[model samples]
Each structure stands twice: as C-alpha cells, then as structure tokens.
Target chain A: MAGIGDRISGTFFLVLGLTMYLFVNPNYIESVNGGNISPNTFPNILSIIIAVCGTMLLFKPTTQQAPDLRSVAITSMYVLLLVVGLYAMSKFGFEYVAPVLAFVIMIAIGERRLHWLLLGIVGMPVLIWLLVTIVLGRALP
Target chain B: MVELDTILAGFADAFTLYNLSFVLFGVVLGQFVGAVPGIGPIMAMAIAIPFTFGLDTLPAIAFLVGVNKGGLVGGAVPAILMNTPGTPDAAATALDGYPLAKQGKPLKATKMALFSSITGDTVSDIVLITVSAPLAILALKMGPIEIVALMIFAFSVLAGLIGNSLIKGIIAAALGLLVACVGQDPEHFTPRLIFGHWDLFNGLPLPSVAIGMLAISEMLRRMSMAHGNKVSSAIINLDTGNPNDQRVTWSEYWSCRFTLIRGATIGTILGALPGIGSTAAAFMSYAMAKGTSKEPASFGKGNIQGIAASESANSAVVGANLIPLLTLGIPGSVGAALIISAFMIHGLQPGPLLFTNQGQLVYGLFGAMLMANFINLWVGQIGLRFWVKVVSAPESIIFSSAILLCIVGVSMATSGIFGVAIMLIFAAIGYVMSSFGYSLVIFIIAFFLGPRFEKSISQSLALTNGDLAQILKSPVAVALLILSVISFVWFMRKNNQVNKADA
Candidate 1:
C-alpha cells in the first residue's frame, strides 16, 4: 500500500486541478487563432494532466519515504520562528531583532556549543548588517 | 567561421583585475562551502545571487561561475578525507577516495582528482567555446512550432530522466507550470490567478522562489534529520610521514589519461542534454570504468582510475551544461538553471540571439569560464588544507546562520519584505513537495521554462491555427515529438524493470 503522503498529494492534485478548470473565468482567457486557442487552453490541458496524474496515483501509487512526525514538528517550529521573526523585525529594527532571532534559530537547530552559538548570534548579524548597510548600501527589513 | 580577434578581446575583458578578483573570491568561497557536507554549490549560488545585485554584469557572473567550478574541486576534499561527499555530484568520488585515504594516500587521491578534474573541465570549456556559437546559429532556424515541440521533448526527457518516479516528476512539473501561470497570461497579458493583488502582477520573485525552494528547504531537511549534519564520521588522518604515499608520481598520473578522457567524454555528452546531471554522469563514468576494467572488484577497494573517472566526469559537466543554456535557452542542470536565472537577472536573455546580438559579452563569459578552470586548479591545490579544517565545523551553526543569510539575499534581490514573504511561502511549499518525494529540481526547471513554453505554444497556435495536423507537417518537429514519446516509453520500461529487480 502507498503511504499517507501519496494519498494526500493525490487528493491535493485532484482538488487543485478541478479548481483550476472550474474557476478559470472565460473572460480572463483571451482568444487567439479565431478562438481555436486561448491563454486558458494550456491551463485547461495542464488541469487534465494534473487530474490524470492524481487519479493514476490513487489507483497505482508509488512508494515514497514517509517523513517522521518529529521532522514535521521541527519544520513547523522553524516556520513559526520565521513568521514571528519577520513580524518582530517589522515592529523593531532589523539590528534589534536579528541577533535574538539568530540565537533562537541556532538553539532550535540543536547548537549548544558556546563559541559557535556566540558567532552565529553576534558575528552573523553584524557581518550581514555591515555588508547590507555599509557595503552594498541597501536597506534591511 | 569563428573570429580570433573577438575571442582575444574577450580574454582582455576577463583579464581585468576587478573581474579576476571576484572570480578568485568566488572560487575561495565555493571551496569553503563545498568542503562542508550538506551545503553544496547550488544552495550557495542561490543565496549569493542577491549579493551580485550591486556589481556589474561581468563580475557578477564571473563570481558565480567561479564558485560553481571551485565547489566541484572542493567537494572531493571531504570525499577523500572523511568519506562523506560534500556535494551530491561527488558521492561516487568517496567510493575510491575514502579507501585510498585509509591506505594513507589521501594526498595522492586528492591531487589526481584535482588534475583530472581540471583536464575534464578544460576539455569541455574548449568544446563549449568552439561549438556553442555554431549551435546557436543553427538554433536560429527553429520556428515556433519546432521550439514548442523541442521544449515538450526536453520536458519529456527531463520528466523521465530525473528523480525516482516519472509520475511524481510529472506532477511536480505540472505544479511548477501552474505556479508560473500565477502572474499573467503570456500572450495577451491577462491576469489568471493573481487574486486581485496588484503587487503580484510581476509574479513571484525568481530569487525568492529559487532560494526558498533550494536553500531553505535543504536547511529545514537537515534540521529535521535524527542526527542531522552532526553525524561526524571518522576523518581519515591526512599527513603520513611517508613522502611516497603523499605524492602521485608522473607515471601514476599519466596512467589514468585514458580513463580521464573517457570520463570527460561521457560527462560532456550527458551534460549537453537537459537534466542528465553531474551526479548521474559521475556514477555513469564510474560504472563504465569498472565495467571496462580487468579488475572490477578492485573498484570500491581504492582504485585510482575510479577517482579519476568520477571526478573528471562530474567536473566536466559544469562547462558542457552551458552548451544548451547558451544555444537554446534550456538549462541542462540545476546549476545551469541558476546561471540562466543570473543571466536573466542581468537583463540578458540566453538564447540564439544572445550569441548573434551580444557576441562580445558571450565571448567574455567564455573567457571567464576558461579562466575559472585555471583558477579552480590553482585555488584547489593551495586551499585543500584549509577546506579540510572547515569540514569539521558543526552543521548546527552553519544551517542557522545560512537561513538568516537567505532572508537577507531574497529581500535584497526583490527590494523588500513582500519578496521575503513569497520566499517563506515557497519554502513551506518546497518542504511539502520534498517530503512527498516530488523533484524540486524538476519543479524549478519547469517553473523557469514555463513562460517560454507558453509563449512558444501561443506562437505555434497562431501559426497553425491550432491545427494538430499542421504540426505533423514539420519533419523536425515531428521527429522531436516522436523522440519524446519513445524516450518516455523506454524510460518507463527501464524504471519498471529496475523496481522489479529491487523488489
């Protein structure tokens, strides 16, 4: 039997294909070659391909390496951290938020070494800040 | 006929101190990352694209090319010393390299790899310099119908040849095409999927999409692993006091000349075709070497020819990959895709017209590519020791710092936070796609080619009034379409047989 990922992706593709086909308004598809083809024509064809692929996977699924829950959790944590970090950087300046964010990310990735942690937290931000602000003359955040 | 004066003028342009310094810097940086496991050249280039925004077109490309070429040389370092390949392309190098290191001949293995790699790269670059112009000129004859058929053929070859499953690869490619359709319809410029957000009219930023998928996704994957990059394999001791063990005598180096030539030839051929990557080339060359050898069993047990075969072929792919990119605007590998994106970013389109219109720029790039090969050799010889030390850095700090750098890069390239948001979203999508066994490389290649493909299709439709029968009239187009069908079927059978064998 196929894994949960295969099933989920299969369903996702089926839904996506159906939505694209059903929702692409005719007004948006400019007709060309006396309406023999349009911009929507390719997407319509792609939608069919997408649907067939989904149906094929449903019936004849291939083996996929199942991702672990812990990995998912870790990825989620990083995403959450980035979202919050982006929010935080928007509120505060990048210089203020960057070091703290860098430090947290390092900890999240299992970096417990003191010097390495220090370098990542302090060295990374300073280097990036100097490069962006001073060298490249680009704004941050 | 190829002009000598233009070529020499290009050499003069590349000889400038500004360009050469960036190339040197790029090679050094490439070696640094390539020594470390997990952070390969593709990830580095994706992240570094934004840094080139402030530089000129020539220096910017020179830097990235140098990084790419340098990474190949540096990848062999950890493969020889630690038995862990620094890049996917170098995985086969560790087969013989690590064993030789265990025999207290790490230097000999590394040096031979360096020499053979330079030889292969040089050979491919010469081929690229000579043939790409004529090829591009030939490509000029292809009409919209032929271009449409050619791209379909490329996609077919790519879908079947890349990744584990053809179905999954197709799904990924289809998804990429869908995502690419988000901004506007290519023919009439009608909005298709932009959800009334005016900011999205320009489409998702390339740097954002690319870096997010390639770089952040990789870092996320590493962080998700059990031991992650922290699994420190035992590093083989490098300096044995014996001088004979450290040196590759002239006879030993000369012995692998034919093996080097064969590997280079294989790599060059494979690299010319879209999507047969250096990893495949390296393994293919290694297989060919072992298959043709008198002592096949000696392969995994520290064969010098094995190292020569793997390194030469993989490195040769770098130069040969540009053949299709420069000639036909089709990238042969992920690395070449990045290079094409870089070219596009610099306001230069890489097609047949690029050769005809921007002849000087094209020649200068060629000169720079040739220059990168020599610099890669020199830098590899000196920096091998430095990179060996860099290999020991813990992956935790590296990944953490790298994620921050990626945000910086994307924001700079796209001019603000909007692009960063796009990157974040794509990063999540990339993680899901990767976890689901979809090919990220295929998705990216498809995404990059989608606009061109749609345009060509639109043109073909206009030309033939959407008549399928008309496409059959063009012999070249019909031949390509048939080849695509044949290739797909052949690969399907091959994949099934392999799966059955495994089962």
Candidate 2:
C-alpha cells in the first residue's frame, strides 16, 4: 500500500513540478535591486528539487504494511459528513446545524449510547457557543 | 551578565493570581491529554493555541508552556502502568517501568520518573534562560548571507536527522515552500499563485494550516486505526500503603544522580539542535546508561536508573527545545513550531530582536517556564488518579468533539467559513503525505520558515550582486555553509548504513 501511495505521489509531484516550471509566470516588472534572483527563482529551484526527488522515489520503492480498507472507508464517510455539515451551516446557521452534525458524526463512528448521543447532539454546540460568545466575547459563525 | 531587574520583574509578573491559575489549568489539561494514548503534546499544544486568543500574552504563553512540561511527566504514567506508552517519547520508560510495576512497586517507579522529569526540566530551563540571550545576541551580528546559510544548515540537519528517507523529507520541504508561495511575492507585492482568488492574496491562514495538518490529520488517522476502540483495561496498582515499595530512598536517588545528569545533558544538547526529537534523546540516554552500568543485563529488568535516564532525557527536551525557537526563530520541534505561531499571533516575532526589544517578556517567559516545572511536579502527584481515568474515556467522544473544536476554532479565528475549508483541504493533504511516509515535521517547519528564507535569499543576492565568490568572503556564512555540506554528507552516509543494515 505504501509503495503504491508513493508511486502516485511521486508522479503527482513530478507532473506538478514540471507544469509549474513550464507555465508559471516568472516575469516581474522589477527585480529586487536588479539582482539575478527573481521572485520566481526560489519556487523554480524548489520545483526542480521536488521533480528530482520524485523521480528517485519512483525508481527505488520501499515496502510498508498496507492500511486497513474498512478504516479508510469509515474515515472517508466522516470527512464527507463534515463537508456536508459545513455546507449546511453556511446555508442555514451554526446553531441549527452544529448539533445535528455532531450527533451524526458520533453515530457514524459507532457511538450508540443514549446519554452520550444526547450530550453530543444538544450539549456540545451550546457549550461551544457559550465559550465563544460569552467567555471569549467572539461571535460564532 | 544576566539582567537581575528584568528577572525579578518577570517573576513578579508571572506569580500573579491569574497567571498562576492559568498555569495550573494548563498543566491539568496537558496531563490529561498526554496520558491518553494517541493525544501527544504536539496535538494538545496546537489545539490549545486558538483558546489562547482570549488570554493575555504572558499568561497564554505560560499556559502553553505548562501544557508542554506537564505532558513530559504525564506520558510516563501509562508506560509504567500498562506497558503502553501514552506518547512515543515515553516508550523507553516502559522497558524498565513496566517491569518495576509488575514487581508491585508501581508508585516507586512513577515517583522516580516524576522526580527525574522535574529535575531534568528545571536544569534545562535554567540552561535555556542563561544560553538563549547570548545566542540571540550573537545572531544579531549575522547579515542576510549568514542568516540564509544558517537556515540551510538547519534544513540539512532537520532532513538528515529525521525520518527514514532524506529524499522524502526534501520533497516534503519543497512542497511546503511551494505552498508558502501561494499568496503574494514578498518583494514585488504581486500575486504569485492566487489563481484569481482574493483569499489567497493574504496567503493561507497560519492557524488553519497548522491545526489542520498537525492536529486534525492525526485525529483522522487515529480514528481510522483498527484498534481505535480497544481501551486498555489494565490499571496500576500503586502499593501506597507499603512504605518500602512506594518511596524511592534518598540513597537510591543519590546513586542515580550521575545518570540523571547525563541524561539531562544529552537531552539538552540534542533538543537544542533542530530535528533531533525527544524520543531519540530518551533512547540515547537509556542506551548510554545501560552501556555504562555495572550490571548491564539488569538494566531493563526494573532498573531504577533506566527509568531515571529515559524520563530525565525526554522531560529535559521540553525546555531545551525552546533554545532554537527563542534565539534563532527556528523551531526545533513540532511543539516549538506551534509555539512560534502563537508568538506571532501575539504580535511578538521570535529571533534575535526578541531579546533586545522584548526583554521583559522574554524574562517573564523564562520565569513562567521555571514556575511550570514546579507546577507540573505538584500537579502530577495530585492528579495521577484523575488522569488515569481520563485515559479511559471513549475515543468517539474525544475525537468527535476535537473535530468540532477544530472547525469552530478556525471559524472563530478567521471570522469566516473559508478558513475551515482551507483546514479541511490541508488535513487531507497532510493525511496523504503522512500515509506516504513523508515527513510532515519537515513540511510544516519549511512552510513556516518559507517567507523568511525567500527574503533572506533575495537580500543576500542583492547584497552580493549574485556573485558566487562573495559567499566565501563572509567567514560566518562560509563556515555555516561548510557545516551544512558536512551535515548533508554525514546524514546520507548514516542513512545508507542503516539501509544496508536493514537489508
């Protein structure tokens, strides 16, 4: 799994570095005191270094234990839920959406206890709001 | 000479009721988080940074320092009790600590660990207080060329000393530099890679990137682990009723004094150097103690010196790691990096000017560190039982709430939803890099140092008119560049040897 991951990352970085070198604008109206190094010099140098390193990584692969697929799937679902909840909060308001998001994430992660679920669903957002608005005197999103 | 007036004033400031209370609070929270497996000090510090927004600068910094110091002592508890180290830095402690616990002397092992930790931390803090000012003064003499050379040396040391692959470390660092170029060009004030987004004009928010990569990504990774639900059922049976088993004799402690001193020294030196982390310091000290022991074979079989060595070294790193951060504006550890960001948030730039410009605050921070060591020792004794229970809390609750906090914290800091989205994006990127065995430490440090590096490079180029020969004219810069080359070669050689041994 690590080997495959490295291969993909290597290729991605390699392509990204080459594209940046080829396409990114290196032109500046004026350089720093007319020195040879431009704003693009640093990034261009870094891109070259990255491309070379990526190439080396691709050539000499290392072995590592594979990650669990079930865990990955669960983690992906949690991320998806987070994105959806954030979107919902943007459309609606945090007061309405935060509790439901917390409750849904708890359930998604296998929390089934009644009191814990209740606390997560209702109590968590209230506590956070109080801490933000009351204690810190900062308005919540 | 040290400024006695400033030192006294700093003590006066740090001993205030509010500061002390926050210090106590930080220690308690740090102990709880550190004693829980999968929640290390770095994560705790990163998560705590946003909360510090509400605090005064001195108290906020003191609070975070208290957390870091408390974590060093707290991590030893589970290592002694269940043979499961709460943090990686305490893994060496388990070799002798668990054995001692199994001998029905858990209290003795824990007490010894606590004593050694406090002793080492105090010594290292004293060293930091004394050494940092002089280092900063020396740094003030450096020109842009010297500063650039110094940064290069730091990068070489970091990439060489950390992680399995130097190439991967470099790649991570390069990626970080690229990411740091997202907003505006430092010199030209033109958009470099904004891609038409005005948010990118100010660059990615530091808090968002830091919290996402260091805290959120790790939380997600832990949530995905197969054994994420398997909380340890084993408990420490502290034979508190038995005096002989519960207490470390004065004689016994005196006998291990040399070992404690050696471990603390090793930890201080290594911790001050960028990229040599506490885990390495602890194991190195442990090995040194074992190698020098008269009964070497008995070293790992419940030897008190083993616990002393490991605990002292790891704890010492908490203070010593600040040496680079306070003096050079280079963070020597993940915790130090987070602290740097906090320093920035408080509008105090780290580096040489900090000592000259903010001498009172610097001394106050030193005083706060010394206070935190004592607080850590006192709190660890009273809160041991409470922390043990905290370790058993359900992962679902802790991580789920933490995720919410991450989101809310970013939103509150940025006053918009965009920062949270940036956090989520970086968290995904961090997770991918970590899974592929890239060094996130290198990446984050490089990113943090990126703008400074670019500025220094440009300044040096302008000063020297891009003349390669002019580099050799500055003795300090030449010496630093030479050291960088030597470190790079040594690191590659060491890595090659390790690879061959593994093969």
Candidate 3:
C-alpha cells in the first residue's frame, strides 16, 4: 500500500508537470505581461521538483515505517468514502449534502450516540449557515 | 529611548472594551488548545483563523495575537504537571520539569516556570517593540535581492540546525520550498501546475496544508502510539503530596536571575531569526544554562534552574518571533506564519506599511501581547488542575477525539473534498518519516518557505535583469549572505563538537 501510494502520487506529479509545460503557451504570456518569463516558470519549477522527488521516492523510496496496514487501510477508505459522499451530496445541493455527509461520517467513525451525530449532522451546518447567511450576509450555496 | 507615545497610542487602542474582551477571549481559547498534547500553537492559530473573518481588523488580530502569546505559556503547564509536553517546544521543559515534580517540588517548579516565562516574555516584548522600529527602518531600504538573501538565510538556518539530523531537516525544507512553488507564477498569471483542476488554481490553501501536515499527521502518530501502550497508562499520578513541596522562594528565583535573563535574551534573538522556533530557543537556553551553571550535573535530574531556563526561553520566543512578522512581512515560526494568515483575513498586512498605514493595529497587537501575559498568568493557574486531568484522559477517548477534530478541522479549512486528499498524502509521508526518526520539520519548513524563496529569487532576478551581481549590491544582502555562511560554519562546528564529546 505504501509503494502504491508513492507510485500514484509520483505519477500524479509527473503527468501534472508534463501537462503544465505543454498547455501554458507563450501567447498566454502576452496577456499577462507581453512575453516575460512564461507565466508557467514558478509552477513548472514546482512541478519538476515534485516529479523528480516523486520519481526518486518511487525508485529509491525511503524505508516504509508507517503504521499497521489495518489502520492505514481503514483510515484511507473512510477518508475516500467521505470525499465521495461530499461530492455526491454537493450534486444534490450543498446545503442538504453537507449536513448529511458530516453526520454520516461522524457515525461511521463510531460515534454511538445519536445526539453527538446530530451535532455533526445538524448543528455544524446550521451554525455555518447562520454565520454565512447572517454574519457574512452571503447566501449558502 | 523607547517611545512612550507609540505605546500610549497602542494602549489606547487596546484598552477599548471590544479589544480588551477579545484579548481575554483569545487567551483562554488559545490555552485550551495548547493544553492538549500533540496540538501546538501553530495548529491552534490555524484553527482560529476562520473565526476571525467577520471581526473588525483590530479586534480580530488582537484576539489572535493574544492566543499566540498564551499558547507558549500554556504549553509549559502540562510539561511541569505530567511528563507530557503540549507542544514540541515544551518537550525540553518536560525533561527537567517532570523530574522536579517527581521529587516533590511541583509548585516551586511550576511557579519558577511561570515567573521566568512571564519575565522573559515581558523583556522580549520590550525588545520587540524597540527592535521593530529599527528593523522596519532597515526593511524600508531593502529590495527583492536583499529580501531573497534573507529568506535563503532563514531557510538555511531552519533546515540546517532544526531537529536531530541535518540531512532530514534539509529534505523537509526542500519539500516546503517545493510546496510553495505550486499554483500560477506570481510573475506571470499563466497557470503552471494546476493540471486542469480548478481547485488547484490557487495552490493549496496554507491553513489547510498546515492543519493537515501538523494536526492530522499528529493525530495519526498519537493514535498509532496509543495502540502499543496498555490502557492503564491513562491514570494521573495525582501524588501531588507536595503541591507546596518547595515553593519557588524569592531567593531561589533570584539565584538563577542571570540565567533567566540570559535565556530570555537568547530566545528573543533566536525568535527574531526567521524559521527558528521556540523549540530551538528552549533547548539552546537549557544548554546555555547547563554549560554555565556550577552544578551542571543536576541538569537532567530535575533542576528548577533548568526548568526556568527552558520555559523562559520558549515563552520569550513568543514575543520575539513577531518582530520579523510585523516588520518584514515574514514569519519567524509556524505559529507566526499562521498568525500572518489571520492578519490577511483581517485585511491587515505586517510590513513597513503596517507601521505607517495601520499603526494602530500594529501597536494594538503589541498591547494585546502584554495583556495576554497577564490573562495567561491568571487563566493558566486556574486551569492547571484541569489540564492535569486532560493529560490523564483515557488514551482511547483522547485518540478518538483527536482523530475527530483532525478530520473536522482539515475538512473545514478546505471546505470539503480536495483538501483532505492533500492532507492524507502528507500524513502518510510524515508517518513514514517519523517512524525512522526522520525530522518532519525539514519538510514542513521547506514547504512553507519554498514559495517565498522562489518568489524572492525570481523577483530579484527580474529586477536585476538576470544580473547575479545585483544580489551583492545591497549591503543587507551581502551581510545576510555572510551571516548564512557564518551560521553554516557555526552549526557544523557545533555538531562536530557534540559528536566528538559523545565519542
């Protein structure tokens, strides 16, 4: 799992760098500053570093001394599922999705009491809504 | 002479009912988070950032500055009471402090720590206010080249001397510099590394990155460590048969008066140097005291003087770290970095312009720090017993709570999905490194400084039309470069001496 994670993250950095170098053309530079260093210099620098570091990590990877496989797997799955739920709920409308997703995550993490889950599901969202809607006066998306 | 007019003006602004209340409010909240082991001032400030959004600028920052000050003192309480340190900086305090407690001198040790911390912090604040005026004047004369050199110096020192191993520290710093490179180049708006993801356009939000790297990873480490320990390790040793065992007499405190004063000065100077945090300051002071003390043998065994030096130095760092943040717009430590983010949220910037343009907020923040010390003294004493309880909370319960808070905190900072992804990735990396005794400090500091270094270098290059000689034209730049060389040599020599002494 550790090797796989490093591989994926490395690959992500590699492709990300390649795409950045390819897409941000000089013409775009004219819009920002009439052809100075391509606006892509900074990000390209980072991308290359990430790619290089990622590749090195993948090849001569540091020895793995992480936690037990069970915790890593369980935690990763839980986090991944939470992200998926967040997106799915946002598609259904963020207000409804946000509270529901939060509640479900709390419960899934082993909160036995419904009241505690309710705080996660209802209280947080409501408070956020109030702050956003009333305090900041920005409507909830 | 310290200008009374600026300070008086500051007091006027800070004395307002709203700001005063905020100062008290922030101190209490800051200490609450600081009392929890594995949650440091950096994480505390990051979590508090969002809450300052709608507040008036002065009050918002007043609250944050208060928190920043309170956190340093708050971290020491647990170190003295239990062997556990609430923050990495306080770990040095625990080395001698806990031993002192075991020897039935908890009160004296606690009182010494408090008094030394407050005194160190007070003197540092005076130094901060005085030194800031001159630094701000000097900062005005700097260009991109000088600033770039300074950042390089800062980055080098942080990576060079922080943690146990220099190699690991350098790696961590490199990682941070790399992270700073994310997003579009500020020089040109062409999106560089977003990879077509809109979310990546602004790069990673710093608060989320910090929370994930520092807080989430911390949670994982805590939980994993707990699994190995038996459940019974949770009970408190409430054997405070000597809560009053050895009161920190006026004479004892006075005896170590010079050490306390020297430690405070060292902490202030270190804190003023960017990227050197309170941990280094505390350890440096402890070493200084031990080396200079006639009874050096008592260092590890529970010396009140050791506790005094460590706690005082670390606490003094709180005020001194703000010098760079306020004068140069560069943070000196992780907590100061987070505090800068809060300032941005409040529509304030900490630079030369801050003194001239937002003088009120700048001085107001200084005033808040003074008030925070007083509040921290009162609140910390009252809250010590409760914090002692928290240190003994069941591992199962504490770990669970930490995990939950980590999840919520990270998610909230990023507003949902993508941020958590970044955090989990780093958590894995951090966990792997920690198990090998590799320093995460390098990665974290590197990630934080990467962009700054890049920006300064690129900006300087642009300004000088790629002329490298431009870097040497500025006296400050040349001086900083020289300092960097000196620091490198000094650190290497020190490392060699230690290794030889061990041999």
TM-score of each predicted structure versus truth? 0.96, 0.95, 0.80
lDDT of 2 by residue, A70-92 (tens): 76676676677778988998888
Stretches off by above 4 angstroms in model 2 are A1-5, A24-36, A64-70, B1-3, B226-236, B239-241
Candidate closest to the true structure, highest TM-score: 1
Using lDDT as the yardstick, the better of models 1 and 3 is 1
Model 3: CA > 4 A from native: A1-36, A43-141, B1-7, B163-171, B227-243, B395-455, B482-503
Per-residue alpha-carbon lDDT of candidate 1 for residues B360-402, written as tens digits (9 for 90 to 100): 7788888888888888888888877778788888887788778
Candidate that scores best on DockQ? 1
Whole-model lDDT, model 2: 0.83
Binned by DockQ into CAPRI classes (incorrect, acceptable, medium, high), candidate 2 is: acceptable
Error of 2 at B119 (Å): 0.9
Relative to the unseen true structure, what is the C-alpha lDDT of residue A57 in candidate 3, on a scale of 0 to 100? 47
Q: How do these models rank on DockQ, best leading?
A: 1, 2, 3
- Local accuracy of candidate 3 as per-residue lDDT tens digits, B57-139: 87887787777777777677678777778787888888888888777676666667777888888889989877897788778
Tens digits of per-residue lDDT for model 2, B436-500: 78888998999898988898988888898888789999999999999999988888778667756
lDDT of 2 at A55: 84
Q: How much RMSD separates candidate 3 from the native structure?
A: 5.2
Q: Choose 1 or 2, whichever is better by DockQ.
A: 1
Candidate 3: pairs in clash: B172-B442, B172-B443, B173-B442, B173-B446, B176-B446, B176-B447, B177-B446, B177-B450, B180-B451
